[model samples]
Target: MTTTASNSLQNIVIYTNNKISLDFYKPFEDGLNPILFTVKTLEQIPRKTENKIHIVILESCDELSNLQINCNKIHLIMPAFLKNKLENDLHALIFKYEQSMNSQQALENLYHSFIKFYCSAEYYLDPQDFFNSDSYKDGYRCINIHEILQDNVSYEQQLHTYLNTISNTETVSFNFSIGYEFSSESGYLQLIENTVDHLTYAKDRDVFFSVVLSKHPLSDNRLAIVHLSQ
Candidate 1:
């Protein structure tokens, strides 16, 4: 299954992995369901069978400059080395733009910049904490030590602190989606429902969290959250 968000001109592909089951949440819309896709028979789909699905979130689309697409079965074409170079260049461009803007505009520009540059793609980071550390002077990339530590912080305290720090700049909100493995056993839906409940009831409002579970060795079951303010 593939999930994509697009406006009239640009499309953003959010995810593209060949996992049997996936779940995600987007902001609520008056006439649309927040649960984007709930495919139960994904395992039956043949490998390399490309399928396209699009969702229209009016508000999100309005703010978006490009469409985001997430696929469960498609392969991204770019080579790793080239992709990294492109990502780094994009980061530099964004940083330069941020430096040119005032604080308030910088924040807004940062969001749009990320959406344009890094959405639906993974960027490489050094495992030695060289880039992740808060002391790092370079802030050109997103996967730094500051973000790793920030993700592990207590949701409540972190959210409150982040909001307070950025309060003068931009208003922020949190959204979460819990993705679980596919199950043939009964009560699978109930399990997912409970997980969603836990995420919704979570006290964090400063960092948006996304919970993903996969059997792939490269991936792990954990909450992937990012702070988005202004």
Candidate 2:
């Protein structure tokens, strides 16, 4: 699948290690509404839109450049000290997992690091607050959740937690609103349980797999999708 602008201008925010890039569909036009801000500037950008905004944080500018070839609507930004802390945490987790000699344990460590990084840095809304906000009116808004993992079980557990929590009633259509970055086929199936549902995987070399859940099994009123990548 290719990244295309649906309609109207969507606001996107990105945080990275002082460098990044974006890639999107061709026929790129002007007037994109995304804002690029450093982590330090997050407080300056008050009144963030709920449904119309997207955010991404890369490890470095080179990663950003690689992303530019695949996504067009991304708003690349630099992270504050948080990025460094997250990186340090990730490094420690990875190193520990590698020494354990268990691939599954390693993957779990990576997944946990990913979740912690996003929850602690990018997403300002608490889980409860996110569900209550007007931005969640149509359901959960689409968000790209990324993580680098070393094993499958850890990834699966993370998916289970995310889907189960977001789909809960208090979430008010939260499951239908977000996308994910995953590393395996089992993880994908775990998120989309039905064989009847159609899955659209992206052709971009950088994106490993993607699926948009048009409807959630728990409720017909809510819609959601998940995107995964290695």
Candidate 3:
């Protein structure tokens, strides 16, 4: 179960307390195969599995505290509404882009979409409080790639060190936005490709990454998101 591409085939195991209907998991099946498992609590989820584990928690966020699940691949569905909201927001943004055919508007939507999705992982802290905390600095959360790059560091080592600093967290989400101050579309695409080549070096870790291309300009022309679980 690799997170290299969105359409890549993956075997998923869904763990839930029957809070969500089977229909909700159907969309993921479009490109991946999923096997459903209903568990009364997180403890019931297997510590070892060949399939990707997705823990869907509809009720208490406290279940995540002091957690100890050992798996190569794991994800969390905290609050239970995140998937539906993401789908809806993306749909709305598509409609808006189609109606206006405004490229800038599309770029803005692209940036907001990733940010919103990253912020939706509210299992540890409320979005507002999380943003206000020292962990969230200059739009980067958990690990700051920019700081790591300044010292000519290894991203994998830096990522591991940062993940170790986070206490009681089994999963971490990363969101990055990259833009070009002035470059051709081909140039931007090349930059994106190169950036991905550099970041996806840690193949042994269970990390999910998403990259969106847009014409929006940023001071540094780069944005990134990395979600990981162990």
Candidate 4:
């Protein structure tokens, strides 16, 4: 989605991949340039200017700490599968707030908790939870992107069923942290197309990447893409 910022100018810098739709940004495009970048590598991204309030939207938290950019506000776009945990947390908090005697007082604390846990950080996600193995071993190895996708390949069976209900063919990205016990092999996967330049990855492994393919809303036969947790 969308992030609210306190800027008269409403300046923004959006990072995207093919899967997410930028149509949601049409209204703000005229007032400000809203610097945008297609996520592939950090080097290609334009450098951030100083003392400016801009919204930065990124696909994964993998490069969040690595990137040396400053912005007034940031939005971490996430995949559909990953939203469950955060939503569950919110629902749980709302329930807790409803039950508490000091509901009004607790609401303020809840707001701060939300901001601090998910929003206030330099980046919204932690890399260790997603890619790093916090085991006894000190060294790590890069897992092939193909292997990552293949491990979750069973989702291919229902790929067509999901694509058939594509009322919106715009980019909707997502972000989530994978725990130390996290294993890609356990998740439900729906693969579309998996063709990247190289299969070997290190920093990128921290990113759980996949794509969803469907027909364009207007165009015929042409495919629309959605990157999972990109």
- Number of the predicted model whose TM-score against the real structure is largest: 3
Q: Please count the clashing residue pairs in each candidate, in the order shown.
A: 18, 28, 13, 7
Q: How far out, in Å, is residue 50 in model 2? A: 7.6
TM-score-wise, the better of 2 and 3 is: 3
Residue pairs in steric clash, candidate 4?
Answer: 20-171, 21-171, 78-173, 78-174, 78-175, 79-174, 129-178
> Taking the tens digit of each residue's C-alpha lDDT, what string does model 3 give over 28-114?
211222233344455666655443324333333345453445542233333322222221111011112233323333333332433
Which stretches of model 4 miss by more than 4 angstroms? Answer: 1-8, 17-20, 26-53, 58-73, 78-230
Local distance difference test, each candidate = 0.26, 0.28, 0.34, 0.26
TM-score of 3: 0.30
lDDT of 1 at 173: 23
By lDDT, the candidates rank as: 3, 2, 4, 1
Tens digits of per-residue lDDT, candidate 2, 1-230, equal 22332333323343333333233211122112222323322222333333423334333334534443222222222322122222111101111222323333322332222222222222222222222233232222333333422233464455445544332222121121122333354754554453112222223212112233222222221122222211
In the range 149-200, model 1's lDDT, one tens digit per residue, is 2223364454444334442322122222122343432443453343334332
Candidate 1 — number of clashing residue pairs? Answer: 18
Model 1 regions lying over 4 Å from their true place: 1-153, 168-230
Instruction: Please give the range of 10 consecutive residues that has the lowest summed lDDT in model 3.
Output: 87-96
Best by lDDT: 3
Q: In candidate 4, residue 228 scores what lDDT?
A: 21
By summed lDDT, the worst window of 10 consecutive residues in model 4 runs over 87-96
Q: For model 4, how big is the CA root-mean-square deviation? A: 20.4
